[model samples]
Target: MLTKKSLIGLTALGALALNAVPAMAQVTAGSQEVHAYVGETFGDDLTDRRISGRTPELDDDVTYGLRYGYNFTDAWGLELSLGQTNSAVTGLPGRDIDLDLTTFDVDAVYHFNPSGRFVPYVVAGLGYASADLDRPIIGAVNGGSVRIGDDNGFTANAGVGAKYFVTDKVSLRLDARYRYLDKVVDRFDDSLNTFETTFGVGFHF
Candidate 1:
């Protein structure tokens, strides 16, 4: 039986398939893609610890970014993505701690139908994530800016998405991914996870 996550992926891919239309030019080898996208990120707990005075949560927020990809073959490609989010650090009373996050990833992609107008693909990658804390914890001894994740804790992700050529050189894209974070905070478990979905326009060259 398909798990819940699998079902969700299938549903998203199905929608892309339904939008398939003949394209003026296919995603041929040596093709490059530049896309500008906006999406939502569902927040995840930064840590399992609920200690008093230790703030350990991130809130859901909107994200925007750009992606660049180069196809080496009709079926294989690599992409570099950069995104940013303005979200709050929850679990703090009286008010939330606002923070800004910057994320980068390099993913390898496999297209199911590079020749089709609606092309669905699977992606996996490793990357880095960092956050800028607005300020230090309100009441901590020897306080300093809190680090968002372990210095060595690397970020990894896997997801599925699709693209539909709207015109000869312009295309519409949809993507959804789950990111597994390294330790979110010092001394806390790094098993944090976040969900993201985006829609964008792509320019093929």
Candidate 2:
């Protein structure tokens, strides 16, 4: 014979029991990860209508970075990364512009299968890019060497990746992402786009 008060108490106990069930994940909450990676940034173009009345195309180049992340839950985490790249802008007459690039990013990551030895994930974030372009430009319209500040601004990116664990603490990682540069160089196009892919070793602790 259950009274009204007894029914309410039973329901509360059931809720408590459900809350005690643990999430199924190989990496427990509060774990931290570090990765060292090397990769490439593919080519892109700048609408430098002032350079030669033609757009300048940038060439593919090497990139390297380090990443640090913290897992808030079995399936969710926060990440920060730092990297650098060296590339060149070609198709200009008589000379090419050398570009030096630096990047920093903050991201949120979601793991789909934290309990598996192979985990696939997605990441999306905001970033900053600083670009240095070195050349004496022959601005067709301006007819002079263009003087402008270094290109530096905000960027947004999203990507998918996978990790294969060889041991509980070590894994191999592969990731690819598309990034949008929001007019870092005010003198150029309103936005620039690029793609990058990386592979590396990671450790969880």
Top candidate on lDDT is 1
Off by over 4 Å in 1: 1-22, 53-55, 138-153, 184-189
Determine which window of 10 residues in candidate 2 has minimal summed lDDT: 1-10
- What lDDT would each prediction earn against the true structure? 0.75, 0.74
Number of clashing residue pairs in every model? 1, 0
Write the residue-wise lDDT of candidate 1 on 5-102 in tens digits.
Answer: 43355456445644755467768899999987777888877666543565467788877788999999999999999988777778764477776777
CA lDDT of 9 in candidate 1? Answer: 52
Model 1 C-alpha RMSD to native? 7.8
TM-score of each: 0.79, 0.80
Task: Check candidate 1 and list the clashing pairs.
Answer: 183-190
In candidate 1, clashing pairs total: 1
Candidate 2 lDDT by residue in tens digits, 1-205:
2223333543454345344433233555899999877778886776546465556666688777789999999899999999777777766655778877788999999988887978999999998988888853345545656543357888888999997666677666789999887754546554678898987677789
